[model samples]
Target chain A: MVQLTTDNSYGTWRFCAWNGMIFMGVFIVFWGIMGHNVPPYGGDMDASVIANYFRDNANLVRLGMAISMTFAVSYAVWGISIGKVMDYILGRDHILTNLQVWGAGLTVVPILVSSSFWLTGSYRPEALPDEILQLLYDMAWLLIDLAYSVTSVQMIALGVGCLRDKRAQPFFPKWVCWYSIWVGFMFVAEILMPMFKSGAFARQGILNFWIEFMIFFIYAPIITFYQLKAIKRIEAGEPAA
Target chain B: MSDEQSALQQSGRAPGDPGVWFFIIADMAMFAIFFLIFMAGRHEAPELYRASQAHLDSRFGLANTLILLTSGACMAKAVMMARAGDVAITLRYLLLTLGIGLLFGVSKVMEYGTKFAAGIAINTNEFFGYYFAFTGIHFLHWIIGCGVLTVLIRRVRRSGVNAENINWIESGGIYWHMVDLLWVMLFAMIYLLPPGGTA
Candidate 1:
């Protein structure tokens, strides 16, 4: 077994952290403060009234496309940044395991199903002939979407198991394991949205969005703050591992 | 041989060097926020949800999944190498890890670039919009992971720090795995929404 010890990396790590924060802070401020960032507060898909509005505007349509790509990249980078910071707090060395890779991945299906459901919730087939309705869903799209939702939920459960397996990986914290278990169930709850009568739960899910927001947007950043404080301890001549 | 032996020794990972816990917590938040946004958006649309997924490319999902799995394995081996405390071997694995990360990153750039070129942009549909966004985020992380690996390799060679510290290697490995795992979701959600012709 190889034993490892920590020493100052010629202060480069500190400089890197400081500089990274500064750059990221500036961009985050612009994205948030300047843009009045509304992060997916659920859209009105049922509003043909609203759809008709966007179905016409030229600039709004183009801007929408531009904004989408920007958000995509944003999510990607932010995800990474968050992951790195969390690892820092945990005092762990093993970062990625097969389990985590799969957990991060398998949850995508349910997530997509959830996102798609939110985006197009307003779609109400106007008295389709049974044949057409059959053909419509039978086109294999709805089934896959449904499967994605269901499978995604299953993946979440599997992810929790994966993350919790200390034997597989020693780096995951106890709080994180429990946190994942709790969080995983939330995604599982999402599957029930489709089963609700007339997407009623879909709307309810929006109402419940704050619960998620509190955990992710609010609680998560708070945890990061704590992690940073712990890192400060390490900097102040404390042992992390 | 003595100089090489000295160079091959790892130092500086006692208690101050970074570790995997930070990255794991980071993974938690990243996925947490992602799930939050996805849930928020999903609650907004249910009908287009099904059809949009049905249009995905399972082949792409499987291929990328394989790529990521291979990368994850390479990274895990790198961690194992670091634990062995052989600077040269650890550096070799780090380089290989970088290569795999680059491969994944380049493939993503190609795929997303193709979409951009084809005029079928990210937001072509609500699902596609989110699809590209999530994966795009993962891609950026992949690039960062490669950068981290590169730095570790150089540090080990230049007599800078502990290349054999399990914490450092594991931290990087965890972060990379997070990226890899995110891709798994991206593949399933964005590409393989339909399996065996039944969406």
Candidate 2:
């Protein structure tokens, strides 16, 4: 049996771990539903049509994107907590731990910036030209999709760290670790987002939006479940075996 | 018997890590989405799909399929050799598998070059989009599979195969087989299936 280290900040760890769930909930409701991005405007949608959408639903888009942007950092907070736990498992100052934390922190940047772009478009839809509105929308999608590698880095680090835990019982199950890596690898498909306008690889297409985004949404709660459980075990000073 | 064999006895006849099956299953599901979407698109525009698919040269597809199946055979043989504690033969078999797999890559690149020469590209149409994206993603898997084979070869060379190291070889073989299986499916769906024919 491997010895589990006692940590003084277990309470904080619990809080940060729970924040992942909260982030998922808030992001789904605010950013996805209220922001009218449940399916998102299509890449092939006309510029004037997009402009009209913002012009018609300005307040909702504004409020939704604003709130979603604020809660986006909760993901970062949850990541930091996961990083601390990984540091405990992998050892202090491990390169993977650093990569995990850094990746998590950087993951917030694209989310924040993209959401702000949408919010800006809705800030005063009437003042911006139709093409400019479409430009902002396009830019947001590119930033969000292309910047996926940062999150991939975070996921791979965590997955590798947990997989390497040679304890009788790893912090995460082997299936979860492999699934995390799979999800990270799946992000490679997002590279097609820039190339397609109206197919399964498009921003609003089935493969890109439905499969990619849903997998990401599903990954959050799964990791949070394991993170909460691991934190609980550590809090009780239980042996890993 | 080695520890891996003993463990295999205990866990039944499952090869490699059972956990790898999860990755394999997930990958299958992902490709299922791609296939489903392709089918859906075909249904939407049957004539266009028929025309575009007609442009594909089945010879290249057939060659690649044969290449992968041959490599998969080599990989299986290598795993058998490793299990038999024949490290030298295992290394040789791995190298052979690597060479065969590289032929698939070369064949695919030449096919793509022919397409480019004829002014057909991924963005040319909906059919081409599906064509490129599906095969392109599978191409990535092939590349990764090649990398895995290289690692296995190096490991066998450096450390030799034993009970502890056998799992790595088994797992790598399983992954390589999956790459082959996926390409086989891709070839059947993209090359063999008539545009209007449902499989």
Mind listing the fnat for each candidate?
0.00, 0.76
Q: Please name the candidate that would achieve the greatest lDDT relative to the true structure.
A: 2
Instruction: Please give, for residues A1-241, the per-residue lDDT of candidate 1 as tens digits.
Output: 2222344442443333343244334323442233222232123333343333323332332343333323323322333333333343333343432233343344334433432322232133343333342232222223322343333332233234334333322234445444543443343333333332222123233312334333433423433343344346545654333
Candidate 1 lDDT for residue B169: 69
lDDT against the true structure, per candidate, is 0.47, 0.89
- Lowest-lDDT window of 10 residues in candidate 2 chain A? A1-10
lDDT of model 1 at position A184: 39
DockQ of 2: 0.81
**In every candidate, how many clashes are there?**
56, 0
TM-score of chain A of each: 0.45, 0.95
